[model samples]
Target chain A: MDLVFAYLDPGSGSIIIQAVIAGIVALPILFRNRISAVVRTLRGGRAATPPPPSAPPTDDRPR
Target chain B: MSAPRPGQGLVREPGSWRDPAGFVYRRDGAIHRQIAPVFAAEWEAYLASGLHDRLVTRGAVLPFEDAPIADALDPATAWRVIRPEMLPVISWPWEWCPGQLRDAALLTLDLALEALDAGFTLRDATPYNVQLRGTRPVHLDALSFERRAPDAPWGPYRQFCRTFLAPLALMTERDPRLGLLLRSFLEGIPLDLAVRLLPRRTLLRLGLATHLHLHARAIGRNADGKGAEARAVRLSETRLRALLGNLRGTVAGLRWEPEGTEWADYADRTSYSDAATAAKERIVRGMAEAVAPTVAWDLGANTGRYSAIVAETGAHVVAWDIDPGAVERHHRALMASGRERITPLLLDLTDPSPALGWGLTERASFLERANAELILALALVHHLAIGRGVPVEMIATFLAGLAPNLVIEWLPHEDPMVRRLLAGRHDMAGGIRGNVAGWPLFREEAFRGIFADAGWEIVERAPIEGSGRVLYRMRRSGRA
Candidate 1:
């Protein structure tokens, strides 16, 4: 979990950016997945969108 | 790599060392993989997870069967062994056309996305992890996946960008040939270097700017080894999925339509008359039928007009051409038709893809994979002979090593097509000297003499009437 030793580089800049990026966009993605999951429950069947893992990932647009 | 492991017969593949989880070897002509003892738990988990079967069914991962540890290089170090279905030919990402590489990138992201849902994470995202199954991409490394650590950052995030997105974007915005940059930077073109070479307009695209230009700056600022400042970065599973979604959209949106290349439309333009074309087809078909090869190579296979004929004999064809646009156009059509027999590639014979990576052997050269049973070299010799002036003896010997049977066409310098190319040449021998005096005379006798010197004997000869074109069926003199 820590960048004590990254398999690729010592700088760990790559890891830091990912964390910052995730922090910036986390809330919107949480809401979207929640809404999609609710929609699947309402349809009264397995998710036609995602989380089933048999089909493709749901499309996501940039914020 | 001859560090000499414990096993007496295991010949380790050069490219298998980068990943510590497993190493692949060849035993009795079939590829065998031995998982390291350290990853035993993960290997067992993977088998029981049903994800292997799921991915295999989706045509994402190459199918494999369990094998005994007794056959491994060292049972002490081995935890599991699997024999994956053999690839007809092992080709690298550098030799692939743009369409092929894009498909590979998409496959990588798709697998990573699906793995997350299944409580697994892809460890790395290098293009080398994927190989072409005909025109399609299949993930070959079984160890790239591991059980997810809750709230952990995607470890290969930068790797995915450096190896796949940067190369694809450079080709899309600049020139398709820029994809060959991957050949030199085997670990994927460095993002900083790519940002410099890429056109400024790339920054105008939000995804490209953030993912490439901005990503490069991030890495640049941390170029100083600040191990003290390095800290654990947590990204929630939802955030990781969001990052993956952004990547998927960016990659899916980037488009490169192959167009306006010299040979992309050469198939529709002037080269041969109707009857000459038909005669050439007859010769190629008869030779293909006679050999009934399991695999064939069509050198200078522009747009695959003749490659389609060779594939009719049920042989998998590797259609090669120098023009990226032509190879791109050829592959797009194969994808559309769902024909898994013809694999089109961008290649230049004068300067072919060479053995590269650790010890210059990790990735195999183009000629190393040229183990095809038949070779169809139609309308290509002139370019090498007169246009490029490569010595005939050199060309003949190289062709001899590729395949046993050959369906080749020799063109004299007097033909209209040859004349046009000749008009562009001034002092002969590609303007290096005032001609070496018939050093490259494309005469019929010279053509026959060269291949003869290369230990090939002519089986049958047919000359297209009054076209200055001759077709021959030749075989290695003593191969039978």
Candidate 2:
């Protein structure tokens, strides 16, 4: 099927530009922890890993 | 919205008008989404793909039953009408806690990737497409997914960025209050605005630099044009998958730890004794059980102490507070405990979420959407009365309008919390000119009289020992 599928419309182009830019900007921020971990390992030191996120204190009981 | 036909018995929802694929309508107290003719092919493909079933099984997508309305409103454009399971409550992105937004962002990315695997992709990445089914995030827009082309970039990428990524980034890095910007920007925060408000240090972060700063510039360059120049850039399936993976990774890594704020650690500083707290809990529990409401709203649900107790009766509770930190902490606790009956939202009762969008009818206001059977205003009246300076009668009027059954805690002026709220007050009855006297004392009779005038019948009144606070279980007259 030689149908000319104009999938990328004007509206779509605008959306694409936003996504591409956002995706590129997000790469470093999102993977900073891993990036730092790798950098630490290359310098012959263990990565300073953060502890797992904990639940908030549920007990609102007074002392 | 289009005018309702003479006797079709259908009212099209205002918010869903933006999407060309279809519009949702309410007919005889049931929700139905109509598939338009333009999107018929896509809709057919989506049903045949089995992805809907897969998503429904995971509780990721809202499950719908195929109930085709015979006498269609406009049969010319209507393709297929299906009835969907109505969510108990509809919460917007601006009201979500940081943890909830992060989870929603991750869920969108996950669903997009999964859709790609099944030869379809989400047409848009708006957070409005997702809604909370309790603590769990559920994708509500069934028509959002369309057949994906081999090397075409994701269409909803920018929307996803604006709606989910941008808000999440700002909330995580700068201040959680930044999430409230969504209420202002109905179409999601502009990239230019986000980049400007972000900290200078964020430039060091690669994600912020490229996506926000650089993305803003790109958008600026193509502002006058229809993005025709950049339309030639074809993103392959491999790259698209990688893109989704990156989004998932970034969203997953962005965590906002709820640090102690004014009301986040309120429970620890309260003057109530252990026995008093227990007694109060028992009273609240007993009152909540008596109402046996399907939905309950807990106003000023700081750290969700009483909200959790209310949820014990198997009622879906919406824990609302002004402090983002408190809501965030409550949300995290709920998530950790695997409790899915309560939703913690940041809401200032004074200036609640307003009815916004076209003709101010699209996204209903907090009070409009929230029509709970039971309302719990525990330890909240003083905040509105003294701190915010809302008159007692006005508070009673608003509370009465919120629900039929209400459990409100009234603290006398002598109470430590109320005193602290009034300590720095110089207004003193006569507008800062007359005597500069101390805070005016709030009497129980005055409070009771106000509620009575507002058509509330007091059912049970319980007092916390040594706290000078009274809890009233009041039912609106003519409602019971």
Tens digits of per-residue lDDT for model 1 on B343-432?
A: 888789999999998999888898877779988888888778767877778888888988998988887766788777677777553653
Task: Give the C-alpha miss distance for residue A20 in model 1, angstroms.
Answer: 2.5
lDDT of 2 by residue, B215-256 (tens): 677777777655555566676565576677766776887788
- Estimate the TM-score of every prediction: 0.89, 0.86
Q: Rate the local accuracy (lDDT) of all candidates.
A: 0.81, 0.78
Q: Give the number of the best model, judged by DockQ.
A: 1
Best by lDDT: 1
Which stretches of model 1 miss by more than 4 angstroms?
Answer: A1-11, A24-63, B1-9, B225-230, B429-441, B478-480
Task: State the displacement of the C-alpha of residue B336, model 1, in Å, after optimal TM-score superposition.
Answer: 0.4
Two-chain DockQ for each candidate model: 0.28, 0.08
* CAPRI class assigned to model 2: incorrect
